[model samples]
Target chain A: MTKPLSTEVDALSARHPGVIDRPLTQRFLPFAVAFVLIAYVFGSLASFDVVRVLSGTRTDLVNLFFLDSYAYKVHAVRKLESPEFVLSLEGSRYAVYDERPAWLAVTGEETDIDLGSDGRVHIKGDTLEYYPKDEEVAYKIKFGPGLVPQLVEGVAPDWMRASDIQVDMRPSLFARIWITKSKIEIHRYFLGWENFWFDFDSPLNGKSFGEIASLAVSGERMDPAMANWQYIFFQFWNNQEWQHGEVYYALLQTVIMALVGTLVAGIIALPLAFAAAANINPVGVARFGIRRFFDFLRGIDTLIWSLIFIRAFGLGPLSGIFAIFFTDTGALGKLFSEAIENADRKQAEGIQATGASSIQKYRFGIFPQIMPVFISQLLYYMESNTRSATVIGALGAGGIGLKLLETMRTRQDWENTAYIIALIILVVIIMDNMSGWLRRKLIEGSN
Target chain B: MSAQVTLTQNPRLREIGDAYERLSRSRSLYTVLLIVVCAVIIIGGFMVADEANSGSFWGGLSSFFDYPADIITGTYAAGWGWFALVWSYLPFLVETINIAVLSTIIGFALGALLSFVASRNLVRNKLIVFCMRRVMDICRAFPELVIALVLVLSLGPTPLAAVIAVAFHTIGALAKLFSEVNENADMKPVDGLKSVGATWGQQMRFGVLPQVLPNFLSYGLLRLEINVRASAILGFVGAGGLGAELKKVVDWNYAADISAIIVLLVAAVIGIDYLSGWARRALIGKTGTI
Candidate 1:
């Protein structure tokens, strides 16, 4: 009886394999194959040697960027004529300091630099000695004839490098020292942006918040021509290193470009949108032509438009504005026409029933329905266009973007780049928030 | 006598009519004022831009079509050679699209993660939401070209630089949009999963993801379209791609080449736009309509 039942079960299974009953491999094989094929294709196309690239990648540039962004190098150069030190940030002449940090001791004969537990570098006329904090042995570097830097044989360590014309000694992680043909220099790395507010030449340099507040209110005028507060304001505003004034102007130009472009585009697009809208424009060919015209304008990207406009207008904010206007006109025309086409016909018909003219029908009946969408989209474009204007400015259409690219090209001006980046970010965020707020207010208020 | 009686007795109706007229009058005045303000701003801005421009608007108007005419004639002169020129730059165009695709993929992955953290309805942690939102804002705030230029300076001019720069921006953009989508998701499914003792990730996967996937995919497609345009633009700033090639041709004054490259670029843009639109519609199941 059991043998017969088992054979029956086998017969039933073989005869009636259900539709849902399939082998797992059979079900998933196509997907698995597709997955593998896609992976293979991407792998071959990207040619990504992940492990090699990751391993071979150097952090030197990133380290430099980070170090340059927040930390600044203070250079104390030993003068040849006198034993005095000319201290400056990045060796800029405008940042020359009459005083020195507490860690630096400049005497008539010897200059001592404290590297804060790393080591001490002592310069005595024609000889220099670097004493590692943990070691007793001091590496002595001698200035040979013609002021060439020379290190004693077998005494130079791995951290300290020496050559005929220059000697670089890394006494600590935070500090470095160099001796060249003309001058001995010590670089002390400090955290935070150097001279962001007041330069070394300013009287307000190194002043605490409370001290600055007091000085602003009660202190004597730092400059004869101006009050203390006025002097501070002017100093910061006209800071030669940062050029905050020029930056502000560039920012203004960017905002203006975006605003003008967006508004003008909206104004131009409104009429063209009607021409593209099928319900508004009865002629099919005309509507098709206008739609394709918009598409052609849009198909040509803003970068191309800007490039062409730059040639015509000869590079300024105007070219950027025009580029934005032309491109946005295409986009806005399409968007606005869609909005118009989607509008309820009842109101328009009702206006027409009341013996209203076409313009009046649109203005009173159609405009109210699409106003919220139009305003919201216009605001959105204005915000995004602000960013686009920056990119256009990089192509020599004038804006903060030009300054940013220019500063970045100068390479060592990373701090200025950081400042400009910060300002741009702030402006963009403000614009974003402002547009959002305005959109909500206008839409809700109209409702 | 009947007209006098109706007029005197319906004083409330007359008052309402008077009030309506005054309101309409004030509204029309405001409208006129707004129009005037807009006109003034447009005119003033135009004047300022004209003054700041290197060439006057009137002078540029005459030569507005000069460059395009030159390009057309040049391309016409080249005849079938323009096609060959376009074909030659195809690889760079592919590189441009690849940069866009790679950036969009990376950006979508990272942005989705960030969006979950940034979404007010999803994340309970206030500080994480604040910090993540601000980080996205900063990322979005940076222009892709600026970042690309900086990266090129540090990392050398390479496609990788463009990819990274565009990716950074995409992350911010997609995160903001994704979070907005997440905000609108129904919470009942999430609550049901939570009642079943599902973990946070499980709840999100089994509940929210299913609901938001279509919208997310739609947004991602739109971002891809945008990223392609951005990557192309970024190439102009020395991050190597078709844009760099175009810049070279432009610098060398190759009018035929410029036209050919532009046609190719326009074609690529329009193709991507259509593909993305179709994909978005399919994902959202909103077919047969614009």
Candidate 2:
């Protein structure tokens, strides 16, 4: 029975070769496409230096971005020539030194620093001494007329890196010191953003959260002119380093840009969509022209649009909004016209059979059919435009994107960059959920 | 007329009439309220944005076409040189396209793997699925520009930075889409293969891939279109591409040069859109017409 069946299958294949076997092109087309795609990808990646990126060196950069975005550095600089000591955070000059910090002390002719586990360092005029923790021998360097520091006593420990002009020492991950001929600088690292709540000038800068809370509740004022909570709020809002107030306002501008841009685009596109829709507008040329116009609008990238608008509007959220409006008009018009074209013909016919006027037919017949699609599409674009607004803002349209670009340009304010990024993501996610919920409600409601 | 009088007199008919009126009224009321709320938000938001903007809306509106007019005049004056300018910028256009292509390829491969893990129908472990979904979410949440900008800081404004950033984002987007596609797939083939002593990988490769490959390819082609736009935009933020060239001309106020780049970019985008749209339709519309 099996042999007979096999012979029958062979006969069938012989009778209908096309049905049993695929053509050579069909068999090899996918493989050919895959080969081309792979070749293009690899060629491009090689040309773009993917190897250098995938190499171990980039991990350092990745770590730097991750670490610097979360941590703040405090620097202590003592100018040898002027003989003055200043401690600052994140290399800012706004150091308040009415009195010395506990870790650093200065007497008449000498300065001493407690370098945590690396032991203490005592510096006298023209003489530098390092006392290694848990060790008796102290390494000493005497600063003289020459750039080099003459080793006065003891063997140099591993922590000491003495060069011609500068003596550098890194005791731990959190602390380092650079003693040069011109100045002695010590950097101590700490987790989290420093002066995030208040600037160095604010009296409340060094206070912990618990301390600030107590200060707020104790009926005592951190600032003599205001209540404690008000002072804290003022300091936080007016934080010199972070600028929480300005950042929040920029975020608000971004949100508003998306909202206004999307709504305005929808409004402007509604009539144009009707003109462009084949079934709604009987004139072929007008419909074709309008369709092409929509295409032209969408074809120009939003970045280019914003750049053009920036020149006219002079770098602000308005330009960003206009860019979004223009680009989205083309997009929404295309989408809306398609929705209009796909509207049920039976509904329009039913309305027309009632002896309704054209305007009334459109109002009662077409509008209801496309309303759900129009609304859901609008909401979806609104959410997406929030992201586009951000990108536009970076191109000099005033919003969080511009603010982010500003922080990023500085290169040192990774913490602020991180903060802004987090906020943008949070807002985007919120917008996403909000638009989803609205789409569900509107679509269901329409039915 | 007597039936109408009877309808008015009957308690049940009266109750139903009143209930219908109340329901319709409430529905219309909700609609009116929604419209009012939306109007207020839009109007108020416009005012706030306008106030925050450096230029007033009315003032900007008056001069909205000035820049475009300038660019047009500049391009016209340049005459035949504008074509040369476009020709010169073609390489930058190619670079931008390359960035998109490489990133999309990388994204497609990674996203396919991630989507498999993320799909509830394919993956038995709920925890793994949950974690993978969250991973995609976080990846998607980060805008490409943010990542590209940061990477450029570390990597020194290379196309690789843009590629990685865009590819990272594409992974999340494609995975989400692919997983949704995965959920709707038939399980009989998978079960049959599994019963035949096929390995898990074998079962997925033989039973599921053939079913979902077309949709995956279609979605991937769609992503390629998006990524092309994305990579061009990323170039504006110092990633290497036509956008970077446009940024240069824009900064220098070279109107003719800017228009040339804009033309190239628009042409490229539209051409890609058309090509990809056709390809996608073919892929989905015809089963054997590779």
Candidate 3:
């Protein structure tokens, strides 16, 4: 054994030069130029205007806190007049105001009245407040499109009454990307294109049904009046940088969560993984039980795990983290255990034959042999888990997935959705390159 | 000195002593940990499970009593807790199996092609291998759910989208596996092919693929089993399958169906495990190989 080891060392050294002598000019020069070109291009494209990106990101955070909806648009924002804005659409009526002290109450609360008997309507006290000192106070107005003459019937400030009732084209600049919403609806008060007494009436309209059977028969394309994708992209792209920047943040969050989950998984699983290896245990029962346990945990989708944990733990980063861990531990554990089991048993035997304890044998022999494989697995899982995190996050466990869902539901922000997803992909690409480089380093000699 | 001499002379006594010592030292800890894990999984799962709403545990057990009849008749109304009995639509359900098998086959076929180019041993062009491997990595790096979501949104959520999503993921997974297997194959045949002035294609066809078939089939079949379970959930995204029904049941607060679906899924998995084991053993027998 001692003679063989010395001879193996001599042979390896004789076959391969100790120093790397590949011509840098031939092998690396092109890569250098390509790297620079890519970096420059990405930097330029990503920055577009450095000043604007920086300012926009900062401006967005400020606007977001105040619940400002006009983050991107500057010209002709649909501002409420005199602190009160009232509108009636689709047989529904509501009043809106700036996010100020005085609050407005737009209610769909119903009160049945015998119209013929009531000569005059009795009003309740303080139905609406234009500018209440506290958030607790809100203005109350009684208005319905069902009453042909009026959709909004209340005494507001004279200037407010005269002001145009229009929705702000700009949602708040500081709007929370996932949660904040800006809605604009054209009410069908008087009815159609040829209809209505005032601006309260919408020129365009659509129908709805109470039941699914009735709905399918209505012959309405589910996403009727679907906007062009290019048009949607352009519209959102023009919005202030900071507001749109939240979408990137959301995407960043998705990638970060994925990485964190993967890291946490590797950190916790490494020790257990060592024990789980078949060679370490050698006992069939021990190996079978551990392997099966790992399988059960990793067998399901991260989303399913997320769903299970979400149900049990409720939605948040915590739930997502646990879900990621629960699955990743199983997966990484399997990979690591297999790697350990596959490592040259001779190395461990050599250490053990020296009368070393199991721990000592593992540390000196198995650990060194399997360390590279473990690192490779960890790197791959990190890249892989990033994709997983996005899906798992969609389980409402709080990450980019939540943001995407909210954006789609509220604004149908396809552009932002695209941006968020694009960012996740970018992060993954970077990780892929890094992992590839590492794997090359690890496997160079063996290959 | 006397004890050492006796131990050396009689190997049996020393072996028995070592076995006893190893067992006495480690057995208790392992048994305890295992028993604790089993207890938590078996008991805690039930304790936390929404069995009360799902029909009583006993009620769930009893429903399986009439599973065959119930599977056909059961819909939104006549659901059994333990037996999802979607067995009546076994044809539609088998379609899920078909999708799983077909997608796995298709994914790995394409992946195998890519893997041939990606393997370092086969391809001396570092750039090509890097690109191909990166492509596979990216493809597989994505979880099926994300792919499903993307495909659903773009393609208007068809079963075809689900199939494509599953296939792409399979490509990613199987490509990497195939590449690794390719790297590990015996080089003798490849060397022989090369000596005969065989083209790279001929070398792969005649030299390489035959040796790797069992490994590829094993991995592909294993993926198929995984995909069957995965595709089952694809329905949650409006893709076709039993998972769609599973989602519907969950949405409608049908606890019984949830339990029934889980049970069915577990059973399906066990069945696949048995089938995979048999196949692997048969292949091993033929090849005298792993």
Candidate 4:
């Protein structure tokens, strides 16, 4: 049997010579030409500087952003009139010092910043000094009354950088000191986001989990009226830096926008889908017109719709929801009509035989068959639209997306941006799982 | 014997009828409750949204057609000048399409790699599959605009940023789909290859890939359609594309220019949809009903 099959295959190959016999050039030449053409087009049209991007020219910027996202800066500024140093995170008033970190010390007229192994930056009166761990000589800078900072002549080392208005010295990678006419400053770089849960002014700012747990169990109220746990919760909820409450509300708004948009779109699309369905409508022109109208709506895209709606509704969740609703109605209409056309006709015929009106036939017979498909599609769209709502929100529609964009625009608060991103990911994952579960349940349940 | 049969039959039939009636009554009650809840939620949500909006829904309802009318009138006033305006913005449109195409290609490549590793049928290690799946999930979770905005900060407002952002999302989406396709694929050829001592790569390339490529291509084309729209939106947030140009025109309140650009975008999207729809049907052999 195998021998005969092999012989038959060979005979068939023999009959179709071109199909079986391919020259090496014939096989590979087209691919080569296509590759060359793609390369040519990319080079000319994109004008992408492949070498520049690959050669690590932009690594510094990338590194700066990456480091900035995780690590925060400790800024200690001492003004000429003020003896005490003002400590802050990212120079934000919200994160200003209630008390300095353990490594920082401010006494009478002197401030000492111990930057771990990177050594120390000390400011005494009008003079600033950076003491490197590896080196014996300290880089010294003295500020004068003439609004100029002068590095002490022979004490200035190779790491010390001086300018007319400021004297800057880097004792190490982790520590820096700047002496200017108006103020003396030291900056210490540390890893990890600081004050994410609670700001400096909060009583619960630097408590460990164990400490917080103990506080929750037995400690006195931080505020006179509230319990210890309540105080902590309030502090974190109203956190000036992170604003967890506002973020949560924005997230809720985003989800609500998606839900409202998807549900409304589904509702609107049902009738429109029936109108577009060939068997239901029967009229070719009307069906054609309705289908083209859907195509137009879908082709307009959500961004353009949002832009147009913003003109009417102005900036809010309504515009975003409407944008999502309008675009998704078209998509859902197209999907739903196809499902309608594919529905089992015998059920509808049975209903029609019972002397039922057309509406009754559709309601009792047609809807039951396609309901599962419609629901599953709607759930899927809800999940996807949650993401789209974020994008729409960025265009001033309203939601966490607007917040994310606003945070991004600040170009500071990268940690907050990171937080927002994490929240979005969390929400999206939850929605994804929820939708998948619902789809499985609904579709499978119908069967 | 007749009296006993009548006595049993009457109670049994009555009980069955009562149970059926009870079940249906409860079911209808639940349905009514569900409908009521849905109606309340929808009405409440609409009210809240209306309140949040700058203009009331009723107030804005009348003026809903005003912007479209303005755009139409402005285009008509241009009297073929709209064509010139669209032509001038063609380069920007091309940039948008380039963003979509490049991102889709990059996404397809990454998604292919990820899908193979993530596929439970393909990968030997459960941990690797789990890790790859989560990575894809995280990638998919991020909105392209969010990623683009972040990238713009580090890379400036360049097309590359949009490409990376869009491609990142595409990888996640396509990987999930591709892995689903892989799961449904026939495993006999893979088993045959394995019996012959074929390597994993060889089995995948020769056995599985042939089965899944057409589906993957179809899905990829669909993704390309989505990415084009996404890339256009990314431009609104400062990533270079037709969206950015549209935003600029909108800011200047050049109604004709806005309408012209919108028309061109619609045309491009519709054209791509038709072309890709045709290609998909051709590749997939028109398997679906209707």
DockQ winner: 2
Q: TM-scores of the models, in the given order?
A: 0.88, 0.89, 0.51, 0.89
Kept native contacts, fraction for each prediction:
0.52, 0.67, 0.03, 0.55
Point out where model 2 deviates above 4 Å.
A1-30, A49-65, A79-86, A97-147, A150-161, A171-173, A214-228, A355-357, A445-447, B1-7, B286-290
Off by over 4 Å in 4: A1-26, A29-41, A48-64, A80-83, A92-101, A106-111, A122-129, A133-160, A170-174, A202-234, A351-357, B1-37
Name the better of 3 and 4 by TM-score. Answer: 4
Candidate 1 residue-wise lDDT, A288-369, digit = tens: 9999888888889899999888888888889989999999899999999989998888999999999999999998888899
What DockQ does candidate 3 have relative to the true complex? 0.03
lDDT of 1 by residue, B87-185 (tens): 999998988888888888878878988888899998899999999999988888888877788677666667777888999999999999989989999
Interface RMSD of each: 2.7, 2.0, 13.7, 2.8
Per residue, candidate 3 scores C-alpha lDDT tens digits across A304-364 of 5665655545555455655677788887887788677778989889999999998999987
Candidate 1 residue A97 Cα shift, in angstroms, is: 2.5
> What is the CA-based DockQ of model 4?
0.53
Model 3 misplaced regions, further than 4 Å: A1-245, A267-291, A339-357, A405-412, A440-447, B1-81, B84-95, B116-147, B154-156, B176-204, B269-290
lDDT of 3 at A211: 41
How many pairs in model 2 have backbone atoms within 3 A of each other, for residues 3 or more apart or on separate chains, i.e. clashes? 0
RMSD of each: 4.8, 3.9, 21.6, 4.1
**Candidate achieving higher lDDT, 1 or 2:** 2
lDDT of 4 by residue, A195-214 (tens): 88887777788889899889
Give the CAPRI rating of model 2: medium
As a whole number from 0 to 100, the lDDT of residue A304 in candidate 1 is 95
lDDT for each residue of candidate 2 in A86-143, tens digit (9 for 90 to 100): 8777567656456777988889888898877768888888887878689888878777
